[model samples]
Target chain A: MTTKFTPDHEYIRVEGSTGIVGITPYAQEQLGDIVFVELPAVGKALKKGDEAAVVESVKAASEIYAPVTGTIVEVNSLLTNEPGLVNSDPEAAGWMFKIAISDASELDTLLDADGYAELTL
Target chain B: MAEVPTEDLKHTPLYERHVTAGGRIVPFGGYALPVQYPTGIMTEHKWTRDNAGLFDVSHMGPGFLTLNTPSGDAETDHAAIAAIIEPLICGDIAGLKPGQIRYTLLLNESGGALDDLMVARSKTPGTLFIVVNAGTKEGDFARIAAAAGNKATLKRADDNALLALQGPEAVNVMAALVPPAADLGFMQFGEFDWNGTPVTISRSGYTGEDGFEILAPAHMSVALWDELLTDPRVRPIGLGARDSLRLEAGLPLYGHDLDETVSPIEADLGFAVSKRRREAADFPGAQRILAERDGKLSRKRVGLLVEGAPAREGAEILDALGTAIGVVTSGGFAPSLGKAIALGFVSPEHTAIGTKLQVSVRGRSQPAEVVPTPFVPHRYFRKSV
Candidate 1:
């Protein structure tokens, strides 16, 4: 039920074995405008720190790394039509995908809200 | 992106202003410049298209090319000076009229573009203003200066600062500060005295939208920039929007779209090779350039409307059978077009408008179609008189 963060600037909102993942607001702010988001397909197995998705801005493109090892169960296809939504509401509606957590212990390796806020600062 | 080494980077006159205005400073062309302001590049780009955007372009090499010997008759002196510079570039410099500007390319002996630049003829006849790319300025100046010998003197105006005010509302803003600036037709420039310092303003810019470029003394430029921004119609822009604007305009950037290995003909800049220069075949690289004019080039620059992910620079362009035909030189989302668009090179056979192709983005082939460029129409001011 708590949100955890990674040093690479991804967030995982834990919900049982399924978790929703997205990039942090700090990452989006640094990225400027989000012109395109290339996400992994559903059922794609991803390892922790693996290249999970891509976020492209008007200036350049950056890789979005996975925070924990899991398999993508659902993707936020809404990003295709409205990429700017990530800039507007990166935390909620801009969530990139849902992953079926393969290992609960991997969540411990990530930072909590307090730790993430400090890391961003 | 890799940070440009801090040791070699320089700062412009407006460097402090950019920091004060919440600009995301980055190293570009060996200068510390703002890539975008707090409003972001997309907003700034739209502002320039609909209203006005002010850009700091002091990093560009803006200097004067004047005759070392002053002949009493200004007309005669200018033609002679133009002749000295004409031999070094592909443009017809001798045919330029007073207050006119011509876009041309400095070429290598093998017909490749050294750098694309703008040459502006001053009304004073013996003098001409030259603007070159920041990255190539040092070498370009040295080359031109060495070639000038005693006939002309190439004065490197590092003390000057350049700014571009672009948009549909650009004229309205410039007219308020200096009325004569609005009267200038596209590709024309004139000097005006405002307050105490003189400012050279030209009805030319990189954006496809109508605009004016102002050249002023380095010390006086900050004041002029402040004065222009006081107008409610104008917003400060950064280099991020500048690249997108020019790309949409179908303008070739020196280092990216053009380089020492790419010829002007292959880059789709044949118009810059003047009518007289074509017939005379007298300018540098004219022999190979003229030969390429009639003959088929191996590849050509073309615009693409990408259907999927934005195809970026260096993406491989593919033909119908998934064969790599060419590579993209500059590609990104066109803010005005509201779709992903790209500029890439392809075999001549695949360059026709509406020709279908594919671009490999992240190892997946995406659908692309060749389209007529300037992805947007240019709106330059043309005087009736």
Candidate 2:
């Protein structure tokens, strides 16, 4: 699996044509303790950078954008009752949704791990 | 969150300490203060409820109003000082016992609140200590100073660092640092010597916790802060937790829950309108304020227990039939309760406790119900007589 990130700090891990999307650890850290997460429903179509979900911390709310255009195949239901998972394990079990890639070429426009690391720094 | 360029923001004395401690600096009230430390708002908030939370509230306006000329008789001097300020607010400053603090509202000519503030009768017979909100300091000070005219002088002390050590263990920390200050009853304040420098400490705080607010010289502030943090029970809390704590405490923040256009009665702060001031009908906007008190008010502020996603500021409040009633002033997740809560104004008829309501978040209506606030009970320390 290859992981790519957006300048807004969302990460999409791709396995074949399917991609799992979630906010990066750095993004969660900046956002502080997660109190609530509002996710898009399954079967929803999203364009690149569309506001796909909302992550709320104790102080404020932030939007999580889609990394690339695709159709949402699944959403992390665990977040409904356990939002803190995003703060504790943002990259793994905290994954927000799964999207089926509609345009493979869009993945090439996302930043690589090295590029995202430099951007955060 | 929108970033305010650091170059344009003023730095508090604790700015460097916050940075060194891994605090996320943010612009608030025109100052560069920490929104949260590395431990985050939830941890800092819970730590405060369970232990002690040290906060830098220096951005607030703390000042003294002293009679320009005291006649040497304590009562006469106090009356003279109080007379100069009573016209500007709805609190009976003249009735305050020495060293006692009263929360009061600064009202405009129309009876709308200009700002809510704390006014204290200083032990020094001719002086009064006042603290106003940070965002409204400049205008508030100017107004107070102008109102004082030649009879009294409003001495601005915003340059001083104001620290609040709050929580259940706050008194214990103070007892160890300054023994005399710990004996103060809730809402009382006194000047004490901290080592060599003089410090004014009040047995009061915004958090619904037993705590103290200390006003100390800027140069000695860092040393005092370092000394306090040495206590294992004390942690440096940021503005993020401070906001949550006050929200749970059901306190109306100056700019959000309160504004220049909100009257004391409409804002659910009628208690701040002193009985003496009400009877005399001498405070600003007394005519309108008294009318509102007598059931002429249209809307009233109420607390809501929201289900599902947090309803943020500007969210619409709706009735059971899905008709809009009002707008939320302040809404967020209450760390102490583990649920979303909000403060909003709705038609007076719909404000009774347990009234079913709804809040539109992102165009979707969510279940909400009117509930008594101080979402968590206030644990202020009141000494038993």
Q: In terms of TM-score, which candidate is strongest?
A: 2
**TM-score per candidate:** 0.98, 0.99
Which residue pairs show backbone clashes in model 1? none
Best by DockQ: 2
List ranges where model 1 is wrong by over 4 Å: B1-8
True contacts kept of each: 0.55, 0.79
Cα displacement (Å) at residue B156, model 1: 1.4
lDDT of 1 at B285: 81
Q: In DockQ, how does model 1 score against the reference complex?
A: 0.68
Tens-digit lDDT track of model 1 for A37-109:
9989999999999999998898788888888889999999999888898899999999999999999899998
TM-scores of chain A across the candidates, in order, are: 0.97, 0.98
Residue B276 shift from truth in candidate 2, angstroms = 0.8
Q: What iRMS does model 1 reach?
A: 1.4
| lDDT against the true structure, each candidate | 0.89, 0.94
Q: List the residue pairs that clash in candidate 2.
A: none
Question: What's model 1's overall lDDT?
Answer: 0.89
